[model samples]
Target: MFGKKEFAMSVHHRSARFLHHHPVAQVLTVFSFWLIGEALVRVLGNPLPGGIVGLGLLLVLLAMRRISTLSMRRGAGWFLSDMLLFFVPAVLAVLDHPELFGLTGLKILFVILASTALVMLATAFTVDRCWKYLGDRKEREHA
Candidate 1:
């Protein structure tokens, strides 16, 4: 039992080292998926944005075990950790466009609220549907 525990710990340590060694590789892996998504959009002329499509493709790959998040987690986490930095540019742009605040301020606020609510509803519905489907599958499997 002790030997097995030691081996498992060693494996975990090695995996951690592997992830740390080439952190940029993880970011590139993600970017490659996005590029592929963009290419697909250009070729297929999809109405959806390439970045969104790429994100969905990444999800599918992760779900199918074709891609592992192990290496990507650190890089992705770093990006998320400093996420507010990304909004700086957009915030600055809005600040520059002070004219937009004069006549269209309320309109922009309304649109932002409406879009946010729509996104929340859509996300909630998708999560509920997926949860139900998975729960039903588990029941069928047990039955």
Candidate 2:
């Protein structure tokens, strides 16, 4: 008894709701994007790591509005909350290497600290600019 337009809207709403409720699906969505990036790298022979490529692809899709941020919110939050887990293996690997306790290790530590600070600063600036841009756009649209 539903019209085409209504049916399409209904499906969209249902799927959006499903994504909102299911964190696993959101995570899978993120993983699938990564897989696509890996496939692209293998096919195109790009020098970048697959994870970086995958993130770039995700950024493009987001910027082009092909994907909605709301759908990724929960999954992103989950990842952020447990981000330390991702670095655990690296920490463990460092422990396995005795050479890392010398001056070389100190140099590596300093580089890691400096790079992390730079990345954090850059990310904060970028987020601030993006927030202002979106706010201004919304105001302009309303005016």
Candidate 3:
């Protein structure tokens, strides 16, 4: 018999409480990871990516509980759900690279195909593990 207000308050309370407790540390930690990601990309002359390292660093924090699931939950969940939208800008670059596509398109296609496969596999594995971990946590909550 819970009303909408109760549901909303509960959600708001969780999000607020998480933000309140570790606001500064969370910001610093994320900033550090992203900075590392940026530095890795620039210093290493990354062909594939740079921001991925920062993401892995954040993943490490999640595993260690330096950041709680609730704290990361909101941002990561939102990002993953709408991540495609974020790629629009990158995709637009293809329009400017029409000549590259026309002349040596096969070479680019091969690289793209391989990289896409790798990325898909990696994302699947990560998402699967996270789902299982969360599922187990829910089961324990009920038990």
Candidate 4:
């Protein structure tokens, strides 16, 4: 639907004002996900869902020091900002499934509520423990 001039104009507009401003961060972000995402979708008929595989790939790259936090800051910030929007589509899709809340809906709802509560509790406990461990380590180091 887009014409060549429109596409070229958009490119010029974007190129005129660099996103995130940092070249390295932009490069890493683009290289780590956008480039890989395109390749995976093109080469592999069945590509993994967005963010999931990209995140795993990013983590692997970070672990290997192929991409550093400094080079990922701007891109990471952009991703964090847009992360919630990505979940909106899935939520909208679920809303289309009104039957999911039919006769067995109550039971399913109960299970989901309980499991969600359990996950929250577990997450809270884990966070508390991690903080405690880190605090203790800091104190010990200072001692």
In terms of lDDT, which candidate is strongest?
2
For candidate 1, the per-residue lDDT at 31 reads 77
Q: How displaced is residue 117 in candidate 4, in Å?
A: 2.8
Give the worst 10-residue stretch by lDDT in candidate 4: 12-21
Clashes of each: 0, 0, 0, 0
Candidate 1 lDDT over 1-143, as tens digits, reads: 55998998888777656766677867776678789989999999999999899889989978997557886887777767888998977877877788778768888888999999999999999999999999999999999
Best by TM-score: 2
Task: Quote each prediction's TM-score.
Answer: 0.55, 0.63, 0.41, 0.49
Please give the lDDT score at residue 81 for candidate 3.
79
Cα error, residue 82 of model 1, in Å, equals 1.9
* Candidate 1 CA-lDDT value: 0.83
Give a tens-digit lDDT track for model 4, residues 42-65: 677646765466677788988997
Clashing pairs in 4: none
Give the C-alpha miss distance for residue 25 in model 1, angstroms: 1.1
Candidate 4's displacement at residue 2, Å, is 44
User: In candidate 4, residue 141 scores what lDDT?
Assistant: 100
After superposition on all C-alphas, the RMSD of every candidate to the true structure, in Å, is 8.7, 6.9, 12.8, 9.9
Q: Which regions in candidate 3 have their CA more than 4 angstroms from the true location?
A: 1-32, 40-48, 97-143
Q: Candidate 2, 2: how far from true, in Å?
A: 6.0
Which residue window of length 10 is worst by lDDT in model 2?
A: 88-97
Residue-level lDDT for 45 in candidate 4: 62
Q: What digit string (tens of lDDT, one per residue) describes model 3 on residues 1-143?
A: 76999998788777657664665545554566778888988988876455688887678877896556655555555556778998988988878877776758888888999999999999999999999999999999999
Q: How much is 142 displaced in model 4, in angstroms?
A: 14
